[model samples]
Target: MLAPLLSDPDTVRAADEIHRGLHALGVRDPHVQAAIAELPLEDAAAARALGRRLTRTGTSTLTVNVGIALLARLGEPEDVPYLKVLGLLRALTRPVVGALTALDCPTAALVWLADHAEIRALRHLIDAIAARDDHEARTWLINAPLDSGAVGPSTARRVAEAVQLSDILGAEQTDTQAVAQAVAQAGRLLSRMTGLRDYRPEILSYRQATTTYTAFVARAGQLPPTPDHYAILLSVALDLHSGPSVLLDWQPGQREALLHALEAVLHNESWTAVAESEPEDPAERRRVHWLRRTARQPFHRATVSRFRVEATVRDPADPDTVEARVLIDGRPLVPEAFGKGPANSPEYLLDSGRLRAAAEPREVQLAEAYCTEGCCGALYVTICREGDQVVWRDWRRPPSRQPRAELPEYRFDAGDYDAEIERAENDRTWAWPARNTARLIAAGLREQPGLLTRWDGQVGWIGTDFHDQDSTAISFTYWPGLAAGQRDKDGPWLQFVWSLPDDGTPPEHQAATALRQLAERDPKTYAQVRGGSRSHAEVLGFPWPEPEDPEVTT
Candidate 1:
């Protein structure tokens, strides 16, 4: 690819071809750099010209990255300003940071770029800034490392470590304001570490977990409680009390003392007044409500229990596969301390038999370990409806672990239990675009399974699954009534892939069109069906019988 850029008379044409070629092949920045690295560095002028041209005129991200990497290796210091401007773009941040770092750009340059960067981009620059003994960078990091957003909580731990939070908190001369901010940030970090659905590095993984948390608690005691402080204290306290003891990697008696200290600060008159006042701001009110509710109804509130269903990426490596977990009174329902693995998605966790109360005692898997049930272990609980109460009992541990503290069975009022279950299941507000698309298709298929009858003799609708950001698939149990597993070696399964348009078409319209087409035409005629299990499964593409009228549908 670079040979063409180096030899071609028309640099613009060569760059455009390389960009389109790499974009089509789905080659990313690193791949481009590897290719460029293999080429001779002697062509410094060509590299600079190609890099400058691509950086200025290239539309695709990969093209600009190639230019940036090339220039980082061969260009002059004059390219610094252009690279800084490129760093402002989120997609280009990593390569731009790399280019600047490669060129040995000043810490102030990186800090300037960090000002416009999101938490994720800031993450790339944090280590470089932290490594350099720049007071400006240190001050900026200590004060503004985190923001109040989804990415903020996940990145809190990294930022805390970059700024050496434990040392700062432990120092006698550390500024009071910096100490307070770091403590509050630690609280958020701890909260994220305690989360159940997401498979994140535990709070204990941080070498300074004990020192940081204990120091935060001690300092929290000295400060007056504000509404924000109350929320942080309450959140940390609730998780510490309810979460697994393993997460409490504090010094002996430190956990207990911290809890006592938090309780005192939280129950103090100032905090109580803030909680009771119910501030007009919605975010503040919600925080206040949590404090008020926790104060009134301790850890395990009787009569009614609150259930919040949250979806977390099961593996950071694979963000598409989300795992859903239930929050029982704001603490994870799954005992994460027991080496629990990721649970199924929202539909599988809530709609599956696990959450339903039946007359007969039925066992269900709450979570599995990382390896699997056979190799590692899994958590199981039995549920049965006894009179007007639904009781969960007979907790089973995975076969491979040591005997840890047993989780007590929960008993809930049937009415309250049923309502909570339905509420969480019905709430689709947390769903992503792909999930919403799957749900829309699933609903339509449930009402009309006959749409796929012509595809095969024994096709049974299983459920919808997310394929990617813009695609979803509806799978089915495809027995075919053949000899046992003759048709599908791994039992019976078939899926119809629905690739949605990039034009901002609403999900309802997409689902309606797909359903109408399935009903009108025989899927077997147009669908390209391939056989095998889901891992290697080749899904049939859902066909469009005709062009859809945009104005006719919502």
Candidate 2:
């Protein structure tokens, strides 16, 4: 799955797009070089996105630097310019940066620091930076003494120059203040590079921390819980596969809304059926609101020093049997920990039941894991919807009735459902470009007005039988109706949840009728309709009537 990226022009283009944007920002030279350096460090797709961010509109040096550092781990050149760039970034206050850099840091920075940094001041500065990071960045910086030839003003001269006489480690220059600052800064950088980014002693402890952190992000209500944040959370989850209950601090009754939007973002599937016209600022805000209001889950709030949410699976049909357990801290958290969706996660998890594909559309199964279980760090946990519901029973189970794409949520004004479906469903004439299903529906109702409400017989020899609310087949019931032991085989897979539109009626009506006619015209469309119990079983397929529209009447 990760292979195609090499030749995928879109990915290269996305990467190119980012690089161009980076050039426009003040980060053109050293920054791009640094990112190029990190390319060997991360995955190609990640590298591409990083390049885009570097090149994207109005990207900050900090953003570019982060991109470069992560990419470098994928395996970028460790060069002079990259090192110089690293020296420039050494001036920030983030712990994550340190560890990330250590994975694929610009090689040049460490060498220069060893050569020219003033000894007395080094201790103080490194300490300052390390302390700021809660000791995370400091843990990774071990000593590799300066070589006499390592010092030079050519590539990263600015680094040497800035090493304040205080930063200088002279035999006699014993300024405690200078030494303290350098020490702090060095320590901070080391923590980031090595053992500090959310390091922990136990897995359960990390889960507790994750919940607390997530809740913090949720409660702040200040940040947008922006798409990028969602993406990071997703990446973290993919990395974790299955971690502890990740409690998130969310405003009471707010977290639910983000789930759907997150789902779409994670899977790259389109959810364009939103009813309300949306504004440009937040792409899926409306959809997010809908999901939150209607997520079919059993979750309750737990409050103590902070607020958090605990979700439990109550629906028998819900496939993601295991739910994410999360805890929250009332305090506001950072943006990276905020939402449930992210465009950046490598593979988006898609919910099979929610997919809306047209009939016979190519099948696309999309579900990917995220995470490892060494169990010691700021873990990422997410509620995954992809393939959670479909227990694909491998080849043993019959093929599914669920299509890969979901029909856009159908809508209409009162009586217009028929008009809309007619327009959406069929058009018999291929020569007429503008021909729609309008004629077909008119013909169907004028002929069999009760067609939508009618049902003929069971679809095939199946394993289950079900009853319905109305006389028509839209509603149904099922017990043990097994032909070859396949569910929905006798019916629409027998009580199978149809993924099509509700054309003011159940699919059974149209489906039964369509089968009859398809057989009449072309028996090949459904060659699998051979039905009968092993002994008394005979071909019990729908009868196909001949005509322009089988279900339609003049």
Candidate 3:
């Protein structure tokens, strides 16, 4: 694209005209996008004019894309915030989100795209950015609350891997506040997502790009839409969020306290939700009613949900230079991160409870995923081999007590719980046959990637996020066809579960042993299951591999 532009004046001018036409019509210029990627540089007499344009002329989103290209070329921290703003500009529409990915600033562009819920890919990119870094970029991602696209883990890992390498190579400085703001925005969005009820593929749409569902009814088929059940189960999450009172009514006071809080949300009338809603703008200026919580609970406060994505040069410059994963509410699931591809997946992972993030390239290595800066912020997850059973430990927690069951909600929305708390709410526990897997795969345009490659495809299989039994926690789900033969006795299965607690773990070294036990039981499971964020999979099962709470106390 650049060679043509630079070599031929006609090409350059013609390209300029194309940009003009795209601006006129509401579409981004893919040609302009490619040109910026290929060449971006202009030095004035002054070392820093604060602005040397990527191209002298373009629309707002185009301008932002050009600016992002310029920054990637210059690799300056000063440009991060600006790029962030530009990203916000383009995020308002679909055309921009699709065009921004080819540039080196996929992370920047993705942050902008996922800010709104109107488009499905927005959540896929959110998983990529949030899972990739612990900085402010992740903050933006968390605030977006993806569209229940199980691509969380796959996309998160891809972005995380890229960020880690860039940091190791000193590509970018740590800009905490900027990224934190992003995370906060993403989290707030998730709280309100309960309104955009999950779509039931009970009917696939031959054409579905309009706001008026009524008008499309004629064109759209009722034969289970392309992405029929791809919507986040917020309207259906009651299955996991709800539990019998006795499940939490333990002798200890903490057990009772945790149970009561969850019940409040599971049964609260205000928490009542309508899965689908009319499309409306939810920008920073727009009064996103859900964000304006009447009251805040620990489920919303003490906890923070983010994706810790990481991609590496195990080789870059490859078709998919990125790998990612999504962390739901707060948990990370390596299986989905490495198995599913997120860039295009319709549904994103929301059920993962924890993940291990890597910042460097190696034949094989494991790293603990970091929680946000808030309350000593959960555990820095670590897993290791221990006999036939895998085991885990919180490098940051006390060696004495380690949590294993799913974690408890940090804050409960006092908005509408009771009215929504029906038996279905309590029964939604992790997508059956693997809710995360089914929902994430269901969102894609083609046969799920996992189905095509588990072991033979170019990238093999990338995993996405899947919830175990907890809305705030996640458990690893298997990639279709990704199989591992045993060392003799009984080889590990193609897919397996590490029943950690979404139950209720404290801030300290709570579930260390449980995680470690998981690693030991099936050391290869993580490798076979986890890693990568912009990845999705194809599987066949329902509520398969039910995870048990790996806690000894309970």
Scored by CA lDDT, what does every candidate get? 0.63, 0.29, 0.30
lDDT: which candidate is best?
Answer: 1
lDDT of 2 by residue, 173-265 (tens): 265544443433322221111111122212222223333233322322221233323323332332222122223333564444443333443
For model 3, the superposed segments whose C-alpha errors exceed 4 Å read 4-28, 31-56, 59-71, 74-85, 88-125, 128-132, 135-554
For each of the candidates, the C-alpha root-mean-square deviation to the true structure, in angstroms, is: 10.4, 23.7, 21.3
Model 2: residue 41 alpha-carbon error in angstroms: 25
Alpha-carbon shift of residue 56 in model 1 (angstroms): 3.7
lDDT tens readout by residue for model 3, 1-554: 23323233343354464456546766564544566556533442111122224322345555445434444444444444444444444342333333333334546555554553344445545544555455557445433443334333234333333333222222232665443333222222222221112221111111211111122112111112111111211212211122111122234454334424343443334333321222253221111122122112212332222322221111000011111222333323322121111111212111221221122211211211222224122223343333332233333322224354542322222112111222112323222222233333323313343332333222222232232222222234333334442122231223332333333344122334333333245433333333222112122222222134322110
On the 0 to 100 scale, the lDDT of residue 19 in model 2 is 44
TM-score of each: 0.58, 0.21, 0.25
**Candidate 2: stretches off by over 4 Å:** 1-211, 214-220, 225-554
User: Across residues 1-554, which tens digit of lDDT does each residue of candidate 1 receive?
Assistant: 56656655577887888887887888777788778767775556766788888888888878988888888787667888889889989888878888888888877888898887776677677656666666676676776644433332235565567667777667785566756776776665665555443344356456777777777777776555777666667656655554432354556666767777777777778777877886786446544544564553223333443544554432111123345655665455665534455565676677453678889898977777656678767778898999999888888877945768877877778888888777667766545444566667766776766666545533433333332333555444333434233465454444333344323477667677777877887554444333334333334333222224221111
**In model 2, what is the error at residue 196, expressed in angstroms?**
27
lDDT of 2: 0.29
Ranking by TM-score: 1, 3, 2
